[model samples]
Target chain A: MKTFRILGRNIRDSFRGVWRNLSLSLASISCITITLIVVSIAMILSANVNNFTSQIEKDVTIVVFLDQNIEEDDIDSLYYDIDTIQYVESITFKGKDEIAGEMMEASETYDSIMSNWTHEDNPLQDTYLVKVTDIDHIAEVAKEIGYLENVSVVKYGEGMVEELVSIFDMIKNVTIVIVIALILVTAFLIANTIKITIDSRRREIEIMRLVGASNINIKIPFIFEGLVLGVIGSIIPIIITCYGYAALYTRLHGQLFSSIIKLIVPEPFMYNVSLLLLVIGMVVGMVGSLRAVKKYLKI
Target chain B: MDQIRVQGVTHTYKSGVTALYDLDLTVEKGEFVFIIGSTGCGKSTLGKLLYRELKPTKGTILVGGINVGKIPNRKVYKIRRKMGVVFQDYKLLDKLTVYENVAFALEIFGLPKDEIHEKVVKALELVGLKNKLKMYPRELSGGEQQRVAIARAIVNGPKLLICDEPTGNLDPKTSMEVMTVLDEINKLGTTILMVTHDINIVDKMKKRTVLLNAGRVLKDYAEGEYTK
Candidate 1:
């Protein structure tokens, strides 16, 4: 009960402090809001890029065309060999007849051209579609599979896959740097803002110290002030990120260059992002106030 | 019992300025002692040492039997709770009213609201400013503001009250009014250690006087003693 009463008083004083210095508090809140907005935007971009990269990775598969004159019994051994490769996730066999049928069904022109073709006359070769666990390791896996006996040709979108991987890597690195820089800048701005408040209240703190107020008693209010500022600063950015992300997701859900690429779904994605923004805001606010109050609280 | 005991206490600032050097003084419980000194005579430094504001560089200070110089950082507040300190420039929060200012001292201890109110009212009543409870610091006169500061200091019923030039900012008449409040508080058995440059008040009060000159005690006298 005593602790609660102290907390109540601290919170009350924090609000009083905030109200007493409205312009400075507003500046702090604005700084946090702007910083969090940039942070959230970066997070959303990273999430989307991650989603796009994974979709592209899923579409990457090496097609191994078998020699037509190869014995049928060797197919099982070939499948087993490809499956044993470390990076290969799965390998599915497609007979020549099945490939011809799929091609004929996919296009009317192909259907007309191959309408009269029978199983014996089909031109397609038996193939293995190899899926790798990681896009970066796909080239290595495909190269190893190319040397397999009875494998006539091995093909994967090597150029496009390498370019996508590098692009995603660059994006990830830049996002980390940007997020770290933003956090430091936010902490600096917020700390300086809280420092101004502390400067104004220096006499009040001195009196509190002289009058036997415990360090915690004097510090709790400023901590509460920082927390309140952080929460207020994050609210607008959270709202904007949520609604804005949902809108962007709706507009660009399946509209990427390739049908296989996609944006992350809005519900869980925005929920997690909102939670992240709030937590970051709170931590940044607290840390900023803690650092700012250290010098003034020597008493 | 000795309310304050300073034994060879020497205080040096971080900038290598020694404010107090081998200064030894003692004040008994309920005694009103005036620490009269010119500027930079180490009078204010001694007052700060009593409140554990500055630890002595070389000597020990015992306030109410506790070694104040060695009091840990966490226990500093506990030591301060037993004493009240008033400053030259009445350090009252401008945003707070007179009533709130006095209550602030008790509020810090997390006293019950009603109890805080009663104590604040009584303290203000002692200072004869109970009628100006609603007035802000800026709204009150210089002497009235100092009275509020005294009320704040004494509201917790501290055993010792350290006033570092409480009347420095007041006129002769106003200073007398503030001094009367301190005297009244001192009469109630709260030992008062007042550091001041105003020889008029010190000579008029004729309390036990300890003269500090250049970080050392020049003279110590009982009541009714006067010095030029």
Candidate 2:
């Protein structure tokens, strides 16, 4: 009970300290708010970039067109050969009839041009759609499929898919690095701001010591002050993360520029980001205050 | 019983300047003793050693029967709680009001809120600042600020009070007022060890005066027996 009472008083003193040192508290709070806002933005971008990278990984596939002279048995053998290749996850055969049907349904122009083409006279060739276990090895899998007999053409967007995947990977990596650096910088900034605040109250701390305040008694309020500052500082960024991300998702219609680049759904994503911001704010605030108070308590 | 017992205490600063050399002193409970010396005579060093602020180079100090010199820095607050210290500067926190200033002493001990309030009010009343409880330190006169410092010091009901030049910055009249307050506190059974350069106050009050010169006790005078 006595410990609880002391804790309660320390908490009150921290709140009072914040209220009394309004300018210093504001400086620290604003420092956290601005840094957290930037961190949230970096986190959101990084998360979306990762999502897009995975989506691309799933969507990319190898398309191997067979020669027009190939027989049905030859096609089945070719399919088996392709299936036996390393990293080949799955293979699906699409005959010329199915290909013509899909092209015709895609547009009236293709349908008019191909409506009279009989199956025997069809210019379209049968194709095998291939998926690989690893997107990075898609090129190797495609090359192996191209060497197969009766395979006339193998296409998987050639250079474009690799470049796009690499770019997405780089984007994800850069944003991650940036997010981490920003969090570290934010913690440093909060530590300095709280240090200035504590420096201004060195006399008060000395007086507390002279009056026989235990180290814990002297430290509790300042640490609590930091906690309060951190929590308060995170409020604006959290609001922005929760409502801003949701609004951005709604405004962009859940994707950016086109469907190929997608944004994460805001429901749980924004909540998770907001929770992270809150935790960072709180932990940084407390640790920063603790460090500053420790220096002065040595007296 | 002796409230303070210093035996062969010697203090050397980090710069190798020996401030006190083999000094021995004792003060019984409820006694008032004045420690007077020249500017560099190590009077302040003795006060600091007694409070465990400055560890002695060679000796032991017992305040309230605890071996204070050997107490670790972290646990020094336990010894400090049994004594109060007043500085010449009257180190009252400018941000806290008079009431809060005194109450801060009890608050550190985690006393009950009601008891803290009662003690704070009583201490302030004794210092004649109960009516000025809400006023800030800057709003008070120098002597009043020193009284607030006194109130804060004695709020813990410390058996011994170590005052280092409590009136060094005050005018003659104000110093006497502050001295009167100290006298009243000492009369109420708190042993006071005051270090001062005010010969007039010392000669007039005529308490037991221990005179020092160059880190050595020059004279130990009884009541009404000290001279310039």
Error of 1 at B181 (Å): 1.4
Predicted structure with the largest TM-score when compared to the true one: 1
lDDT of each: 0.88, 0.91
lDDT of 2 by residue, A191-250 (tens): 999899888999988888888888888888998899999999999999999989999999
Off by over 4 Å in 2: A64-97, A107-134, A140-155
Regions of candidate 1 where Cα sits further than 4 Å from its true position:
A70-73, A251-261, B14-17
Provide the lDDT at B197 for model 1: 94
For A130-150, candidate 1 gives per-residue lDDT tens digits of 998888898899899989999
DockQ of each: 0.65, 0.61
What does fnat come to for each candidate? 0.60, 0.62
TM-score, one value per model: 0.94, 0.90
Clashing pairs in model 2?
A: none
